[model samples]
Target: MRIPGPEPRADGGVGAVAAAGGLHRYQLWLHAEYGPVVRFQLPGAETAVSVADPVLLEATAHIDKRPERLFEFLAPLCEAGNLQVLPTAEHTPWRRLLLSVLAGRPSHERHFGQFAALATDLADRWAGQGDREPVALQKDLTTLSLRMIGAYALGGDAADPDKVVTAFEEVLTEHLGRLYQVPVPGTEEERARRAAQALAHLRATVDRVIAAHRSGGRTDRSDLIGALVEAGERPARIRDTVMITMLAAHHTTGVAVSWTLHLLGRHPEVAERVAGELDRVLGERPVPDYADLRRLPYLDMVVKEAMRLYPPGPYGARETTEALVLGDYEVPAGTVIFYPFWAVHMNPDHWPDPEKFVPERFLPEEVAKRPRLAYIPFGIGPRSCEGAGLAMVEAELVLAVLLKRFRFRPAPGHEVTPIERFVLWAADDIHMLVSPRVA
Candidate 1:
């Protein structure tokens, strides 16, 4: 079947996509203009097929191989192997290990108190500031998420949390910001040098943590480092795993909550409902624990709806291993299939007034009316985010704690723009005025 898309410009199809601004924006336009399946060209690959329909995705869901070329940006960070493009034989075991640790409720429960305490520490700081200036919502929240993950995974706080966060940001900005660019000798070499330094700093930090765990300086085999060491994972592999875990777990949860707060800022009514739920459920408790999550359904809906609008990772891709048919389109072996979740989340067919913020849209009855894959903020199938459960728990708890204590309003004149930076993040960072809630 012939796939419809924009005609390739003189520079080529990839150039056309760039002219459309960003990949997410181009995908949205392609789906709107040419229906669910649109074929477009990339630099080295043949025509890539992008499927926007959630139902159509099921046919390709079982294909678990990631596009190696698409993930090469992560190559520098990993020494044991290209962690981002592990062979199926290798990926399965690695993913299974991560799932065993990340998916289990016990791991989350074991660390819930730490997570709550860390979140409260930030809230306490905000209270101290007392609106001296609007909190850099995304910046501070991202730092908090990183700290939570590090403490949970390593079983303690980093020796220098700020340094670690700074290192990670430098590495990501250097590598991810110019993912597909051709190398310029001098400029590229300088970027690589800085990236390498940043990567070294991160690796050093993880190395210290692992060393502590191994020598009995710290003993928490239930934590990720101890668990992996127990499982006999090599030092390099453990370090790589720690780096990747830090990268994956941090910004996504932070961005999700930031966007939710932004939406609630716009809709005071929804904010009131979230505050009400938190007040009734949490009462005198300043933060939530594992059990409290069940009692806060509206807060859950608000987080879910926020994710639907601004999913941490805007899109994911799977390279077709065998010929597959999605709708009327046939995707041949080796074709890269792009799943544009932002577009799917905004698909008008499944969501009425898709752009509007409406938490009730996630109410059980309303959710049941839509297709199962229609709202894939964390993705679907085997390759979906393994931290989905952990992220939700972390997000819901943090939201409950922060909202229960202080109400967030977008600082006047600050505009929040969602941009793809590995994860969807506000362009200049989200700024919110923090105020103490009257009891």
Candidate 2:
């Protein structure tokens, strides 16, 4: 049977996507008009099938490969190969190794102190800003996340955190700007040179860390670089792995926290509930310990709901290796299967009053009623983020600290808008009036 979608346009879906604001909104419109499975034109992929139903997603879950053309933008980040599009044979082991460290409790515990310190420092800075100054949640929080991941990925003392953050931002800004045609400051040649230099610096920094690991004969399971080196991954692959890990970790967690705060700012009652949970859990303590995280289930619920509303990475794509059946439709071999995560989270059948912000939707009994893929902020299947576990820990901790210390209200007269970028980003940054909370 034929999958439904909008009529083809000469601009190859660009006009439609832009007309609807961005790809995330475009996906929502497509699914609303065409049902769960829609075959549509995706600029690079030409014709793609998007599945917004969680039950339908199971069929595509095992399809491990991502469409290469869609991910070619990330190719320049790696010297070995773009980690996103690596062959399944190579990707399987890599995913296993990443999961071992990124998904491990010991790694998270080892990094908890550093992550808390970073979060506390950001809170301190925000506190110093005083209530009158509106904090740029996206800017400061993403920077804090970058620092946290830097400390985690490259040991706390391996490289200058500020330099690493600056260099990575330079590399990302240049590459993503070029891809989106965002009109960055310098001429094309200048931007390219800056990106190349930043990439070289980042690669060299990873090499230094690798050299130290080799010389010391370290094989720490909690250490990302050490684990990769101990696994006998070559220097280039190690560099690529670090680059990709940092890249993936940096923005997603930051924005998760920022968006949560953005939601809390607009919903003060929910913010108060989150604050009450933190107070009951930690008393007067400002930041949460690693163990304290599991105690604050409400904060976790809030973060999950926030991600459901504004997923950090709004959409994901996979390439089918064989023919498959999705509900009433049959997709051919080598088809581009789009996972509209944001839309899936908004599916009315699963999420009643899908537009409303209600943290209770994530209550244990409530969550048990929905399909597994319905709330996939991290994504689904084999290619899902290995950093999911870590990202959650980091986000919850940051939210715990910031909410425990401050009352965030929307900055007066400032409008917050969500636009699709490398991640779902606040186009103008989420500005909030952050004032200290009284005991």
TM-score leader: 2
- The alpha-carbon lDDT assigned to residue 185 of candidate 1 equals 42
Candidate 2 overall lDDT versus native:
0.92
TM-score of each: 0.93, 0.99
Model 2 regions lying over 4 Å from their true place: none
What's the C-alpha lDDT at position 371 in model 2? 89
Residue-level lDDT of model 1, residues 157-230, one tens digit each, is 47887788778877877776677453434577787788789899888878887787778744443578878877
lDDT value for model 1:
0.84
Q: What's the distance in Å from true for residue 373, model 1? A: 0.9
Write down the worst ten-residue block by lDDT for model 2. Answer: 155-164
- Model 2 backbone overlap count: 0
lDDT of each: 0.84, 0.92
Error of 1 at 76 (Å): 0.1
Model 1 clash pairs are none
